[model samples]
Target: MNFQKNKDEVFQAVANATEEAHRPQNSVKIIAVTKYVDSSIAKDLLKTGIEHIGENRVDKFLEKYEALADLKLTWHLIGSLQRRKVKDIINYLDYFHALDSVKLAAEIQKRANKPIKCFLQVNVSKEESKHGFMVEDIHQAIETIKNYDKIELVGLMTMAPFGADADQLKDIFSKTHALQKELQQLGIANMPFTELSMGMSGDFKEAIANGSTFVRIGTAFFK
Candidate 1:
């Protein structure tokens, strides 16, 4: 596969979408979801100017972390993190995109040797298969976790249901963006709430239109 060509195409698409949406080109951060590929491919992505990479599983995350330790890449843990596994991976993560519960937050607070940026995951689509706080409970969840000193609440993360149509995806992303704004107004200490991490390969254009600051892409880049 022509990785550089694919990377250029994705960047161009991101630029077009941002322009159409009237958002600044620099506003969106494209995170290469490296879960589907091994460290060898991930290293190639770094050489192609991809600075952010995400992995969902702890085992694979660690394996790649060791293999690619020489590189200066930002690591994102973008999966449902089990509390028991937090200790194994917390120190290595630069951004934790699946902080769904106060229980998990507490564990991270107790375990992390340094402050970790985190996105509170919200189940905006209310899909039974997703792991996150329900839309209605996000406010309470935020309030509960605000006291965690080691976790820096930087933004919110969510996933639109697989195969959802454009309108559905837009609606989900719109509501999540609204929630991010609402939380920003709360002025909670240590909670910047400046990011909305939504969108994937299939519907990132819709997400960019609705104010997604970070788009996690895997399939489009790997192919």
Candidate 2:
């Protein structure tokens, strides 16, 4: 699998989804997950018009960040974060995609120096292998998180069930979007949930069509 070929495929997927969605005002953002690869691949992706990449581990991210600090990049945390690592992530990361627990959220709120953006990871798929706050627990977690002045709840993020078709993916993405709306109606309007971080290299186009602003691309960028 050629990396460049895969990148082209992901780029096309994003563009096609954007055109199909017909939301002329909004463009989809693809955060390429550059996990464990090198900075050269990141630079290649940047050259191909990708400006953001997610890293699962802080240590690995730092290794790539050191070389990429000079380049314009947005680092997103797409991994389950431990309490001890919150301070370190707070020091570097601009956005975290997996704030799945309220306990962890509190720690992040305390450690966050600036107004850091966040995505509440919801277990829409309800899978044991995945890490996220169950759908039923999300509202209470969001309510608790709303009090933190340092963290801004941007939207909901979800990892769809494996082997899911396009239709299933759309439903999950739409569900995440609806969750955002429910939160807004509950007087959480000051910080509107504008993003639905769902989808990946596999079913991202469908997620986009139904409404997904941030797509965490992994295998597509890492081929």
Candidate 3:
């Protein structure tokens, strides 16, 4: 695949969608989900001006982390993390997009050497197949994790059910956006809830229209 061309196309799409949505330019960060590609492709992506890279598994994340350790890139761990793996990969990540439980937060607090930027994953759709806090539990979850100094709750992350239509995707993203606003009003310290990491390759435009700040794209960038 032509990584540069794909990267340009994705950026163009993001720009057009942002303008169509009346959102500010450069508002959405495109996290190239590098889980499916090898480190060589990831290095090529960095050369194309893609600064943010996401990996969903700890083993693969570390593999690429070791291979491309010299490049200046913002690394994102965008999958459900097992507590046991926290100590191994905590320091390498710039953002963790799947913090859903108090136990995990406590583990991160115990293991991280510095404040880790985290996006609490909310299962906004209440889908049993997804891994996140249910919508109703988010407020309490936030309250419980407030004392964990090692974690900086940056925002909420979620995925719409696969095969969802545009309207369905919009509803999911809009609801998550509203939740982010609600959390921000609480004025929790270090909780600058400014991001909404919703959307994937299929529904990113709808996600952008509904106030997504980061969109994770894999197939679009690799194909």
Candidate 4:
């Protein structure tokens, strides 16, 4: 695959979406999700100027992390992390996107040597298969999360159900964005809540229109 051509096309889409949303240029960052590809492809992707890399599985994340140790990259763990595995990779991440529960936050607090930037995962679509705090439950979760000194709530992350229609995508992403604003207004010390990790390869345009700050793209880059 021609990485540069793919990169240009994806970035142009990002630019178009950002412009349509009336958001400032460069306000959104793309995270190249490398969960399916090997470390070698990830390295080639980075040469296209993608500084952020994401992986869904702990084993794969560690494999890529070790392989890419020679390069400067911002690692993001974008999947639900098992508590028992926290000690293995908590310290290695620059951002943890699936901070779904207070229990997970506590585990990170116990295992991480320093503060870890985290995005509170919210199941805005309310899909039974998705892992995240319910929209109603986030306030309580934040109350409990405030005490985890090792965790910094930088933003909110969400996954709209696959195959959702445009209207469905709009509703889900709009709700997620609204909720993020609500949390930002709380002015909590540990939660700056300035970012929104919404959108994947398919629905990123709708996500960007609704104020997504980090769009995680995987298959688009690989294609």
Candidate 5:
């Protein structure tokens, strides 16, 4: 299928990007950003040995997820999850990215029927437009996580400010890694903060260097 071919090229690119970054110990898992991209393509990509496909909206993800239950795919809620929509997002999706606040995290924990995996979105760049918890609020979020039962805080994820100068990209990704270390050391029971999900189509190489375990690529893979 054409999607397999696309997935191969994307995987090869991931390997090449991983090698190019020269962080052999650090592996980067790619979540084919399938928002607005149909389920047929998602299935094709899955057939090509992909397990993760990210969806940016709660409603659309639920609709598509229900339609494709036969396929073994991990749906990622990769958009800003509103508190009101938490109940909706918890139904079908398990792995998630944009948990912007402790309140949202708590709502996810309450609504989740199973032990869902989540990444704390960090605003490393401290940009006003980005959807994430501030660095200072990390511990508070962790504390909030202790109150919830149905979800596990797996790691952290972030997107740098758009048009970030190459020179400033490292600073952003590195801050994410540094925060990951700090959070990991806190020893949040079963919630082991391991994955650092930062990087997009452009600065993925730099994101790898700073220790990104997952990279959400849309244009890079789909184009």
Candidate 6:
């Protein structure tokens, strides 16, 4: 695969989308989701000037993190993290995008040596199979999270339903952006809630238009 070509194309697309949305330059950052690739390929992608790397599973994240230890890259755990396995990868993460529960936040607070930047995952689409806080429960979750000194709530994340059409994608992302704005208005010290992680490769354009700050793309780069 032409890694440089893919990287350039993705950046250009995101820039165009950002401009079309009338958002600030560089407001959106892409996470090169490397869950399906190994460290060698991830390292190759990094050479093309992509600094953000994401992995979905703990074991795979550890393997790549160790293999690419010599390199300087921002690591993002963009998948559901089990509480029991928190100690293994909590300290290594730069950003945890799947903070779906306060119990998991408590676990991170227990294990982390430094504060971890986390995105409160919300089930915007309310899909039964998806994992995240329901719309109404986030208030209580944040109240509980305020006590966790080691967790910094930086943003909110949500996954739109698979095969969703443009209107559906827009609706989901719009609601997520609205929720993020609402949380930001709270002025909570630990919860800045400034970022929104709302898109994948397929529907990222709509996400950008709706104010997504981070979009996770995996298959697009690998292809």
lDDT of 5 at 192: 89
Which runs of model 4 end up more than 4 angstroms from their true locations? none
C-alpha local distance difference test of each model:
0.91, 0.80, 0.92, 0.94, 0.80, 0.94
- Across 1-223, the per-residue lDDT of candidate 2 in tens digits comes to 3666777787777887889888643478888888846778667776676778788887877788888877888888888889898887676887888888888878987888887788888888788998998888876777788888877888888888989876778778788778877776676743577777888888887788767888888876665
Better of 5 and 6 by lDDT: 6
Off by over 4 Å in 6: none
Q: Which segments of candidate 2 are over 4 A away from where they belong?
A: 1-8
Candidate 1, 1-223: lDDT as tens digits? 8889889999889989999999887899999998888889888876788889899999999999999998889999998899999999999999999998889999999999999999999998888888899978887887878888898999999999888998898799999999999999999988999998988999999999999999999989878
- The per-candidate count of clashes, in order, stands at 0, 0, 0, 0, 0, 0
Clashes of 2: 0
Error of 6 at 223 (Å): 1.3
The TM-score that candidate 6 achieves is 0.98
Q: Report the C-alpha displacement of residue 171, candidate 5, in angstroms.
A: 0.6
Model 1 gets an lDDT of 0.91
lDDT, candidate 6, residue 21?
99
Candidate 1 lands at a TM-score of 0.97
Error of 4 at 7 (Å): 0.9
Error of 6 at 97 (Å): 0.3
Candidate 6, residues 124-202, lDDT tens digits: the string is 8899999999999999999999988899999899999999999999899999999999999999998999999988999
